[model samples]
Target: MGRPKQFDPDVAVERAMDVFWRKGYAATSPQDLVDAIGIGKGSLYNAFGSKHALFERALRRYRDDQGAVLVELLERPGPVRERLREVLELLVAMDLADSDRRGCMAVNAAAEVAADDPAAAELVRRMLDRTEGAFRALIERGQRAGEIAADRDAAALGSLLVNTVVGLRLMVRVAEGPERLERVIDAVVDSV
Candidate 1:
């Protein structure tokens, strides 16, 4: 029989996630995983099968942890526009505040791994779909309450909001300050 594991797999995955988030998949080495997870190479393989498998788990963990924040912000009780503004503002704040400037993990994964990795692409796509759906639902709520124009298409608006967020997240990687992001927020909120 195999030996019992010494470390918590969940904690290991979280650590791996941090490493992957800070460094894209191609740049992260096996030794990086070994050091971050505090496990030997063989044990790491035994626990997660391979680097790709471990990255998948880490991405899923990011989805559960970071992706949930966007959903929660959108679901907060308030005017739809205000809630959307808060979501955008919070994203800017969080992205800027991160010392590593990692930007959105899902977004980074989409840009880095989505082309060559189908599983990772699908995972990122599903997160985008869920986020767009949440925005669509919130927009519908606003339309029902007469806050948003009834003539506006919620689906299209939702897609635009998702696109805007995607751009904002990517932009934060190169953004010099909050000024440009604030303007983007103003323009998007006004358009909605």
Candidate 2:
């Protein structure tokens, strides 16, 4: 309809996501988005409605794109213990290799706006729910496969692991190296 959108929506959103990811919602200006995404002001407005809408789409994209790995890993048909270990190892690697130390866009959004904005809070809540659900399924699978203690509550354990990941992501934002993460991984896995 409108010139068929000159750029790829995915690529443009990815670029916009990087801008928002680097700078939080309040700080990321429309001009910044224009500069980063190479999209004109009118086109951006027409395509995305507003900055907040664009952010929501980008955040959803992030979870759907980057977070798919977690969902897939959790769903894998394997011993629960090994799957959990794999999840933690992947988490650790993500923390260590994060060049920008962006500390997870979802977590960052949660910290930045969960208390103030209803829309943002809802987004944060959904992200948390999805993450915890993945963990719950993994834990349940472990219990079913005789890998995890049967007495343990999968929902609670999953919530705990989600919290651990949030904490670990936050810690990596300030910590210089992986020493703290190694200790954390050991503690989390050993407990499970």
| Model 1 CA RMSD to the hidden true structure, in angstroms | 1.8
lDDT per residue for candidate 2 within 1-192, as digits (tens), equals 556448777888999999888898899999999888888888889889999999998888878876787788888887776787778778767867878888888888888877887787787778788989999988888888788899999999999999998898888888878888878878888898
lDDT value, residue 15 of candidate 1: 98
Off by over 4 Å in 1: 1-5
Per-residue C-alpha lDDT of model 1 across residues 1-192, encoded as one tens digit per residue: 967559999999999999999998989999999999888999999999999999999999999897788888898889989999999999999999988889998999999999999999999999999999999999999999899999999999999999999999989988999999999999999999
Q: Write down the lDDT of every candidate, Cα atoms only.
A: 0.93, 0.85
Count of clashing pairs, candidate 2: 0
Question: Candidate 2, residue 88: CA error in Å?
Answer: 1.7
